[model samples]
Target: MQTQDRTNVSSVEAAIAASQNYLLSIQYPDGYWWVELESNVTMMAEVVLLHKVWGTDKTRPLHKAETYLRREQRSHGGWELFYGDGGNLSTSVEAYMALKLLGVPETDRAMKNARDFILERGGISKTRIFTKFHLALIGCYSWRGIPSIPPWIMLLPESFPFTIYEMSSWARSSTVPLLIVFDRKPVFITDPAITLDELYAEGAGNVKFELPRSSDWTDLFVILDDAFKLAENLNLVPFRQEGLKAAEKWVLERQEETGDWGGIIPAMLNSLLGLRCLDYDVADPIVERGLQALDRFAIETEDTYRMQPCVSPVWDTALVMRSLVDSGMTPNHPALVRGGEWLLDKQILDYGDWAVKNKQGKPGAWAFEFVNRFYPDVDDSAVVVMALNGVQLPNEKLKQAAIARTVAWIATMQCQGGGWAAFDLNNNADWLNLLPYADLKAMIDPNTADVTARVLEMLGSGNLSIDNHSLSRALDYLKNEQEPEGCWFGRWGVNYIYGTSGVLAALSLVAPQSHGNNIDRGAAWLVSCQNPDGGWGETCFSYDNPALKGQGNSTASQTAWAIIGLIAAGEGTGKFEKDAIDRGINYLLATQQSDGTWDEAYFTGTGFPGHFYLKYHLYQQHFPLTALGRYQAIFSK
Candidate 1:
């Protein structure tokens, strides 16, 4: 793993060899790898399947997962992301059920603590929308109070304001089946289930409600106790059948060959449960395929057990290789060349959902995977530009053509504010963000700090740099984006740490060395923010909650990201750089598993900070490898 033994070899070739090994070890025998995305969703999907498939009577994987979850409960008696101090409502409910599934008694100290916390926080009625839906199924909460997303919603035309495509990928997946299940209204009851009266707000289920005046859709589903009493008296079987049929078709149509629905497990689990409730047998091909997919998502450790949203070795490996090459690893090295080829082939030449959202661009961004058309984010494309710059392409004409096309595509996406949003530009209409069931807060937009820094860095590579209005505007955006505290805000990753790191990297290229510029100030802010653990971390709550202030336990991936930013700024010789470099390198070298991987369970990336976060398992390994390679190049020499 040492960087010194390899010399004069192309970084790409060396990267390919190393990445192949890395990918191979993680790949399941069934031909896929799983990564933890967010904590609550993964645990929820797994626990649901544990009860529905394995039966609630046993104490094996469910018991182990429950024990792990209970140990992670915060002082307030609920779980946060990655064993943090504060509790999130959705996370607590999901963990509570996983414990319940394992036959943990309500009188148990942990269970009692959790129940008290839930009651204190306005009860389960005030939990996030999705959590309420799950609680309703087990009779813990009443379905009447949940927002009205009637099954007829599936009948809404694409031109309608509430078309499925407008929703985020996660929401679309879950909403479709929820439409079916709610229409059927099959309430699963057991002796262990808690009643709505015991768990929700007093008199909550009986209360009548109306749509908020600001809602965009004219149709809203609300059920007063009087309204439900009247509807239940009238038999409407045919209408319910039609709604269920349409929703079942919707779910089956979207299921991937690999049994993924929107590449998120919650959608798949809920949809499969809906199908079974619709009387689809266990032997059904859809059910069989659905069950197999779950096996690929689980991760087992000696101390913890959990599942990831999806696996992504391809994306992680590419960025690590580029980081190493940028730090003077040779372009011809085996690892770099192999990684370059892998990435080159993965680029999206044809537009997908991103282009559809952008509405006016040619599709030329790098996807997270070889063929995922649903969510091709912008950060990966910027990273691809950096990676492509270092390796030699087999087809020079083709390479130049690809670079030109991709860079132009990114350039057009620059917003009025000068930064680049990941998927689309300037899509910041708050009116369009009115999903009642989704937990995501505000989304990333063109002014996002992380996107701006990445694009600026990529453009600095000479081939992509344009001195035109677009480039100048982008520069102005980055300059304007620097916070009064000398840090930038991270939209696609965590909080200030990610934002400051991104700003430093971008300013290093945009700010000329001749002028003493904001780069020094930005770098200093990053150094000041480092946690006492000799590593850097940022909490997801920083997206809108000013109170969180980028809080979290230190993690290796963020630590490496900070160091990489400093090195890219040409401060490799400074005291701050030296300390960061040594700490990051040592953390990686010491924590690496016997198989050359590292498992840092905390999420270091955010698709929409506070709204949607991800845990790229390989990020722990590849990012550190890249950072250490760069540090060794500068200091070891």
Candidate 2:
């Protein structure tokens, strides 16, 4: 047993050394880390549309992007939102249209196969609202076929049922500009060669836009949608001009100095197109700035190019800094100091939309993007505070002030259910999801267990204790939110493992004595769900189906999450815990690359539940290192 313990200790130490060195090697000169955030082929398709709308002859780049899209097509001839998932209808339609515009013939085998798959899945008519809107812009689908999203939504007051403040930051940022495009209904007349008629099914013409009557409240929203359409047709919308001006002002105000709106592809693209529709010349400084900002998202290779969904330097740096410190790096190490300084500079000291619902807290939160001051998120703020607290900075007084302000701000963002959302405080309005334009399924900013647990962990890391009212309420919320099978839903990460890990870690630090049973159950669940290879993985499909939770091929990141959760659950003395940790550590050691980092191709981050996903390239490196570090600290001692 002593010999076995020695082996385990050596294995963990080696992994920690390799991982730490690799992480340090990748740090930016400014002390940040950002890896490519990979998504579906839809980004490629959108780039094609952006070029076509602006009448640019970037054919060489377009052809390269088309090549990337074709390369990603599954055997079924369609693109999935993520790897190892079934083909998606909206992704397929958009890809087909983009390829057709790139001059791929209808008789091409790939195009023919894609057409068949789309037709069987109910054709272009069944695609998501965003895809339909894109088609409408190109004069393929009629604007009437798309849902009504008038600029007048901006005019609604806070007391109104559905105001701009009610939408999630991502949705709100994108919608503000989309309202302009929808009102203007701009159609850039492309060459006669570019048309989507060949991609649609025979009976697509008969398809009509109708409100989904998923429930009575939904039925009412449908009626409201119809009313809005009537008002639009008859020019009866109240404050129409005022609403348009307000929306334009809103969009212009949020456009980041980087030129992108909110630093996201959708918002950036929509804002550009919206400005164009409003008769802002292409040479307008804002339009020019927007074009320049988009150039940053594109990655051009010799043969193909891909666009990032968004940059994540701020978020990545915070996580990496935490991992490095947790892995036994000194708090005042040069890298640590640089990261701390960088994060301190990124802190938002001005009010954002989150203030609408949370008017009391002073601004000290952090945004995921470098320049999205109008929309700082609670999750990023918590992580940044935790990192700032962990590191020893030269300006200790300033760091403490930043931490205190962030903690206060996060407390204000807590909802009635004692949980925290990503961006807004209490932006939950389920009825709004019933709107026809909400096919993306991310309408409101409801509190989630994963984010709430993260906040708890952050608070616990600081001077806050379990006796604090905010921490106590959050504990109760987490207890009630746990699944019967003993895992929590991961709203931002892959699935149950991520949530369970986050909750267990936070509880261990904040309320360990009171959560014995919860911790044990979560530990048992993690042990039972371990893959045969001694690692762990969870599919994004788990978001849509609960039974699939904690089920998939083993991955480095998910496996690390499980190991860390078990360690936090007081599995120090148990045989199962000992065995599980041993196996998990060996798996990491076996999988580590020559450069000391692990390779992961799977999509582990959640964007909009079932509709969108993300692959944070740095996740594989930082998380596994943290897990190994924690294991060594407890067992090696």
Candidate 3:
């Protein structure tokens, strides 16, 4: 990370001043920083059902949630996953129902518009498997239409090809608890009279409501689901009782003392409902902790309340800390020191699920959320370790030891093809994506350029060059993965602009002389992608169509990514290539808000590519400062 030298330009200096101050003012007293992890209204919608299942809807403020849902409703009368996304079927259905549960009459204008959007899109039948799960539980949709995952899968050994361990951490955590629910198939009617009878395209009875079918692979899963349902109906399974016991044991053991299971809303909600199906009282200490953990995910305002898909204190703190350092904050400044200490305390000394497949690892990594010790993310761990390097911690010995452990763990966790996945080793089972139950199509975790390059960047920051075995192999993986257009595909981020920039930075930092050609090609691709407004942007649609890569209205975060990419590609120097860099810097200067912030509403972060997206509110603020600061470090006189 390069600290900026004070620049001659007044606007540049003033912009840095505003951003630094704005960041400092928001740090928590306990020394971490967090911003909202905003997804679509579906998170808010699911929380309404959570309240009803807990039987707390009458006590909790559904009206506040109503305000947030209405606020995000597009003029099309449907809610979207991100800004300017035409609309989505499942998201719209969830939002419409949540409002109705809040007492908004079906004939109300907002409800009418939402209902039209749902019916026009083929109604409840076409919604996703997970969405169908919610509707079925409330007695609106049929349990028969949903796909099944029999609990006996829990009994499969790790040696089995299709064991649960083959799935990603998020998928397994969600599926395990749901297995118990699948076995019991419990349906609780909070209000028996209210059903989604109005939203189905054909009348509820008239619609055949077939199980999901897409391909030959899906056909195989459909057959399995039907066979499982038949055996369940006959009570003929050999290990039925033992499978339930194993699943219950798994869910109970994974819960944190804080009530969080798997550090995601779906996992936590499923676990609670699964426990309820087994007849655990709401007053049980386990259920109480689960409720409290979810409550922690909710953000309330004067007139609004909404739930985050997950909390991001660990992820947010690492990014902000790193960007602040790169933007010229002192290494030992109080804020940085406190944040570094807080982060150090978060390192997992105990192994989680990742250890099941990884024997070379002891737990010395970090998770995305505060209490998710069971599932550490490779992306978050890399960023956090990098951020720690920039801070001048007082206990230098402790810091160095933790860094060494993290480095060793990261090195051994590389996948077979010289790439790295997010949470597990060698989880590139693409065949799983075709299952009828994989409607989200995000069941598997595969290696991509963004995560591989980020791993390289972390290794580089530790001063390990191409000489290291991991770096050499990963370089090959990244090179093979680059698109013909010179941009790499970004799996964790929006599209090519993000992947191109990240790879360029990693290449320049780690293997500049050896990989200079690759960096140059990527920089040129990023330059050609610049918008007329002197910034760059790529829509989420780019994931669906490669031709749309790096194409969209410019956003502050994407522009900063472009600017930083140019700098890291050795183009920020004023000897040449100043126009593009200067124009990019100027865009940041001109758009700077008076209060030392940048405002962006577009979603740049990816959850599952086209299926789910995130708008990191702080992306606009910190990324621009990091870009301008780097430009000043090189070009300022």
Tens digits of lDDT, candidate 2, 1-637: 5897788788788889889998898888987787788888898788788877776636337778878878888999888899888799999999998888788888999999898889898887778888989998988888877777777778888887768888888888888988889888877886534677755665656656454457655677667778888988898878788988998998888877779788789999999888888888877899888888887888888988888888898999999998898889999999999999999999999998888878787888899877888888988988898888889999999998888888878878889889999998888887667678887789888989899999888877776643367777888999999999999999999989999999988877777778878888888899989988999999999988899989998889999899888888874224348788778888888898888899877889988899999999999999999888888887788
Q: Give the per-residue lDDT of model 3 (tens digit) for 1-637.
A: 2343233366787888899999999999989999898899988888798778778777677789999999889888899988899899999999987887777888899989999998999999889988889888778887888777777888999888888888888899988888888777777877423678999898777876568666655587788878877887898876878888999999999999899999988898889889888999888999989988888999988999999998889988998998889888999999999999999999988889888889888889999988888998888989998999999999989998888888778877899888888999888888888777887888988777888888888877767433467778898888888888888888887879888988887887777877777887788888888888898899999988888989998889999998888888874221234678788888888888889998877999999987999888888988898897887777775
lDDT of 1 at 353: 47
Which prediction has the highest TM-score against the true structure? Answer: 3
1-637 in candidate 1: lDDT tens per residue?
3664343123423433454467446544332233444445435434553354423324335445665776677777866754352676666766777576556777789988887777777666566666666666776566654554546556667567655555545556767887767666567754355444544445655533322232434233222323543454475433556766888997887776777666656676778768756877766888767766765666666766666665564466556656556546577765566666666666676655455456667777775543455555577788877777777766657666777778878876776566777666565545434434434544223457778888877877555676567767776777777787677777766667777777776667665463135676677666777676667777766766865654667777887778877776655224345576556555555565656566776777765555456666667766766676666666655
Q: Which 10 consecutive positions of candidate 2 have the poorest summed lDDT? A: 569-578
lDDT to native, each model: 0.62, 0.85, 0.85
Q: RMSD of each candidate?
A: 6.3, 2.0, 2.6
Candidate 3: regions farther than 4 A off: 1-8, 215-217, 465-467, 571-576
Task: Order the candidates by TM-score, highest first.
Answer: 3, 2, 1
TM-score each candidate: 0.76, 0.96, 0.97
Specify the poorest-scoring 10-residue window by lDDT in model 1: 216-225
